[model samples]
Target: MHSFTVQQINEVLQGELVGNTTHSITGVEEIRNAKKTDLTFIGNRKYAKFWADSNASVAIINDTIDLEPGENRAFVKVKNADLAMAKLLEAFQPETPVFETEIHPTAVIHETATIGKGVQIGAHCYVGKNVTLGDGVILYHNVSVFDDSTIGPQTVAWSGTVIRERSQIGAQCIFHNNVSIGADGFGYRPADDGRGLVKIPHIGNVVIGNGVEIGANSCVDRAKFNSTIIGDGCKIDNLVQIAHNCIMGRSCIMAGHSGLAGSVTLGDGVVIGGSASIKDHTTIESGATVGAGSGVMNNVKAGQTVLGYPAADSRDMLKQWVALRRLVK
Candidate 1:
């Protein structure tokens, strides 16, 4: 366990500290569950209301909130308490798994594959012919990099990740367990004789930019013609799906269970809420926010917020809801 004095934690957060600075914090916990030796945070009024009853030794609080540190408890006031807590948690993070050797005996590497410096290939991992793994790449156990694929420097693929042929992933990207990149897109057409469906071949690949992090079990499908591109700094949540030929601009955020159909386009900084689905060929401009559970069938203008089953302007949807409630009354 890691331990730090109230004063030391305050310095790390660079926040204003009030009350006792000598108390020791052994770990972090939720506001309601915190012990006397634990540290916690109050990011909003909901949590701030419980401060007086919390037994935590130190609490990081948002500067916008007006609260006092009671008795021996200390308060580290910052502009954003959540972000401040993130820094401390990173500092206290446990060590990650280290490879026993750079290349494990059970791993398979093709003679034509290019392995860069500081790469670690774990047991049962496979690097196919013509695959290029850049410097500092780490492939955990059971990971597979198929032919002609290229992974950039410092990229990490955890256990069970599969990078299919011709996929290109950029630097500092992370693929969590069971992530599927360059998977065949879901496409089929009715046969000429109407006997059965004909599968449409996904002949292209997936191109992901730098600093992208895909959560566990997420998938990015290969394109039908050109690459399905994910711009730099996008953060994808677990169980999300990006379908064939989808193009995402920089820093887009997709919540858990959200999905985009084939050829959907998102501009920079678009935020997709949980379980939201975008129809195929739809375009969402930059800074647009799609509310949770929304089914977007039309284009969303830049910076607009949409809501409802078939998403509409947030204000319009709210007005319609109000009218319905009045009718019920």
Candidate 2:
């Protein structure tokens, strides 16, 4: 961790500095775990009680927080403590390794592939025919980019991820370990002559927009016709499944274990909570939030909050929960 004097930190964060300006801060930590050399934050009002006794020499605090008399601690007051802390953390974060332009000897790159300047292909990876990788793209060990796929500049794909044929990923996207992009959709037809299911070929690809981050072990299926789209700035959490032809709008967030069935549509800024499931062909309007463990079977109006299995409005769900508790009593 990098050390910074409180005065220097003040210059960086542009916060109102209070108390010992010369104190050296070594690292960031939680309030309960902070040491004299560590910086902590009180972003919530409930956490203010811990601040008075905290060992932290420096803290990031909201502008409106109450500072009691006789408190000797130093703090940087900002409009939003959480955002300020995030900025500070970014400044102190270590630099990531950028491999040289040369592909590792163990990597298999087709002769027909187009690799841009400063691209890094790690060991045991495969870049198939006509694949186009943008400048400074990094494919870590065991990554595979199948034929005709295009990856935008500065995108990083971690180990064991697969970008299937014809997929298009936008700039600055991150694909975590074991992510499967553009896998065939789960589409099948009943076989004739009393046979088993017959596979339906997915003819389209997955298109991920700029600055998207797909978490580890998530799978995004190829579309039956057009693209299965993940819009700009969307964040998908670990173990999420985005099925065939699903479309997510810009800045939508899907929490861990959430699943979107085939052709589901999410408007901009929709938030799907952990383990939530959206049924096929459903459309969730902009700014809607689906509560944790919800099963959304139909359309949700803009800015609505839904909860429960076969989700209803949050107010109704709360009333029902209260009624159930009364019955038990």
Candidate 3:
């Protein structure tokens, strides 16, 4: 545990100190789970009542809120308590000692592949032929990069993330555990003989832009003949399925369990709530919101907020809700 005086924290975070600055505290802790010698935060107004019996020595809080405890607990008042706590955590975080450059004996690398400077390939990681990994990229244990795949600079892939052949992922992107990109899309036709279905070959790949984040267990499939494109700054939640050839616009938020059919286009700043299904070939303009559990069946113009099944206007949905509420008699 790293210990710092209350005065040192006040100078580093630029917060006003209302209690003893000479007191020393070690590490950061939540208000509910705090112990002695720890710095706790009270961001929620509901937790204000618990401050009287708080076990921590120092409390980081806002000036306007009243946390009138019987005992004197050191208070560090700031504009935003949550933001101040984040800065304290970032400063006291323990960093691992970096090792000097050396390749392990168990790793195998192709002679023709391009490996940039300052790259680390951990044990049991396989770098295939014709694959290119940019600078400062790290492949952890048991990671695999297929042939002709290009991973940009300073990106990290957690455990068991498989990048298929010929796929392109941009810089500073993060793929969480079990994220599958550039996989074969679900496309099949029923056979005439009634025996089985025929699997259609997916000739295209996926193109994910920079600053995109995909949650765990989500799969983005490649297109049948065109690329499955995820635009820049799009944040996708866990278990979301982005089908083949879906062109998502910039800065859109897709919540959990939401699935889009093939070739759908969503404009910028669109927000989708949980478990919404968008129909194929539909175009939703910018700043539109699809409510939770909505089934979008048509193109929604810009700045529209929709709700319910086949998603009507938000005002209409609320009007119907009021009329239905009185029918319980």
Candidate 4:
């Protein structure tokens, strides 16, 4: 186990030290699960009571709060204990697996494709005509980059991921396993002859900004005319679906199983919880938060917290629920 002295941790956190700096902390854990060699943190006031009884040898605490006077545990008090804990966790994180520069023998690269410096193309991967893979990009096993696609420097596409035609992926972006970027939009028109629906040609592509991380099995559909845009620092959880022409602003977060229908627009810092669904053409303003299992049928104003099916303001939804319960009585 990797260990660091309390003083060393204090230096990195820039926190006020209140106890034994010489003590060694080997790992980090929650207050309820900490061991004597573990470091824990109290970021919220509710967790303060656990400080006195926690088994951790070191605790990172918020500067605004105070622990009990007689507690034996050591402490590092910082402006934001949660942020400090994240830094400490990152410091202790293991490095990612490295690959050799040699391209795998089974990989197929079209002669027209542009391969950049230090790129690693794994077994069974295919780089199609005019595909441009920037320097230091890694395409793991079974990945595919279709014709005219451009993946920026240091981007990574895990196994079974596909970057379809004309997709533009930015630097340091991460496409998790089985992710499909630039897939055909689910748009269709009623056939004139009363036959099956005619598929609308998705001629446009997807433009993903830098630092975007799309989770496993997620799908971002290509646009009908223009691009489906995912802005910088957006984090999309597993199984999420972003339909064609959707434009998401920077730092937006969409949790697992959440979905946005066609032409949806999300302003910066909007958060969509698990299994939430936004109707087509809806606009979610900046900093709005849609709660889990919500069905957003209308535009949500900035800074609102919405919840429930055919979602309403969180506070209003609670009142409605209370009224329904009273009626059942």
Candidate 5:
């Protein structure tokens, strides 16, 4: 385990330290579970209440929280305890796996492919014809990049990730294991002759912007005509699905298991809670937030917060809920 003195931790967080500056902290843990040598954080009132009974020797606390350091313990007070803890965790992060070679011998690279300097291709990885991988790109074992795709500099794709033909990915992006990009969209219609359904061809591709991070098993389908776009700094959680022609603006966040139907539009900074589903062609403007498990069937105004199935404004939903409870009584 990595160890740091209370003084060192305070320096890393740029927080004001109180008491036991020389105390050693070996690891971080939740306030209720921390040991005497562990470091913890109190970010809100719920967590702050547990501090007095916690056994931790050091704690990162919000400046707004009223608490005094007890004997033999130390407190590092910062404007945002959660953010301070994240910084400290980065300092303590373990080393990541390193590739044994720049390009593994078992990897297959097409003669027409362009691989820039410092690129690393792991075992069983495949780079198809006319593919362009920028400098410092890393494709972990079993990753596959199909024909005509362009992945920008410093992008890292983990095992089992597939970037299909004509897909364009931007710089500093991270694709977790099993992520599927540029898959054919779900589009089908009944056959004219009264037979089985006919599949609609998805001829376009997926375009992802810089600094995006897609969690494991998430899928972003290719567009029916032009492109399915994900803007810069967007973070998509595990198991999420983004359908064809969806346009997501910068810094949008989708929690685990959330999804957007075909042609859905999300403006910058939109937040979709876990298990939320947006209907086809629906628009969610910038800064709008959809509550967990919501089934949005219409457009959501910018900065509005919606809740419930066929989601309505949060305030209206709450009032309806209250009325229903009274009716039951």
Candidate 6:
């Protein structure tokens, strides 16, 4: 339990204090849950109702507000109280987590692998031959990087994440728990004489651009020849399936459970809603948005908003709904 006097907080935030400046704040809290020894901030004027006879020792407030400071609670005035609070919180917050710098006893790192500075290889991790890990990379428990894999600087792979051989992930990428990259792509043919199926080999790997964030339990499969590319600044949500050879452009956003089939191409600033499915080889242009539960089979023009199965135009979908409602009347 770290304690900071009101004077100490003002030094950190360079804010003005008034009304019983001698009071000290023990901890920070939300407006509704604040205790007598705590400091809570109020931003919106509508939330001022919660401040009546509040138990907090101090209120960090914006300078624009016209209010009187009471004896029970002092006021720390600032241009932006929220941003000021962030500074204080960061200063008082715990240090960046330490996974031991020394390789764990259970970790198996191939001798040929190249690991850069400040790397932490956690329990039971397996690094294959020729794998290259950049500076400040942290691989949590049971994560595996197969042969020839390369992870860029400042990346963190959470527990149970797996990168198949030859995969390449860019800088500052975060792979949440159980993410599987460069796993076998689905390419199969019916066996001879109507026998069991024969699965073709997935020969390619994945290339993730810088600043891309992939969520938990997502699977991005390997392509046949070329790399399956995730463009820079792409944000993907949980349980999404990115099939082989799909290329996402910069700043594309895909919501939870969305699936893109093989060879799909998405332009910059495209937004895909939750549970949407884009068909194979489809091309979606820049700044286009596909609504939730949409099934996109054809190309979506730039700056267009589409919705529904087979993805009709947004205006068309709305008109159809309106006509359906008029039928009942």
RMSD of each: 1.0, 1.6, 3.3, 1.9, 1.0, 4.1
lDDT by residue for model 2 over 1-329, one digit each (tens)? Answer: 69999888889999998877445788999998999888999888899898777888888989898874135568788999999999999878988765654689999999999999989999999999999999989999899999999999999999999999999999999999999999999998889976899999999999999999999999999999999999999999999999999999999999999999999999999999999999999999999999999999989999999999999999999999999999999
Candidate 5 Cα deviation (angstroms), residue 329:
1.5
Cα lDDT tens digits for candidate 3, 1-329: 68988788888879877767344688788776787778888877887877776677788888778754334467888889999988888878997435244444666877778987777776666777898988877666556778788888876666677778778888878777778888898889988898899999988989988888888888889899879988888999999998888988998999999988888899998998999999988888999999999999999889899999979899999998889998865
For model 1, the stretches where C-alpha displacement exceeds 4 angstroms are: none
TM-score of 3: 0.82
List pairs with backbone clashes in candidate 5. Answer: none
Candidate 3's C-alpha runs over 4 A off are 21-25, 59-87, 92-103, 192-195, 291-293, 301-303
Between candidates 3 and 6, name the one with more favorable TM-score: 3
lDDT of each: 0.96, 0.93, 0.82, 0.93, 0.96, 0.90
> Scored by Cα lDDT, where does model 6 land?
0.90
lDDT of 4 at 226: 87
Query: Where does candidate 3 have its weakest 10-residue lDDT segment?
Result: 96-105
Candidate 6, residues 10-65: lDDT per residue as tens digits?
Answer: 77788888776455677889888888778888776776777876778788888887
Shift of residue 247 alpha carbon in model 6, Å: 0.4
Pairwise TM-score winner, candidates 2 and 4: 2
Q: How many residue pairs of model 6 clash at the backbone? A: 0
User: Going through the candidates in order, what is the number of backbone clashes in each?
Assistant: 0, 0, 0, 0, 0, 0
* Residue pairs whose backbone atoms clash in candidate 1: none
Query: Model 4's lDDT to the true fold?
Result: 0.93
For model 1, where is the 10-residue window of minimal lDDT? 17-26
Q: Which ten residues in a row have the lowest lDDT in candidate 6?
A: 94-103
Off by over 4 Å in 2: 68-72, 98-101
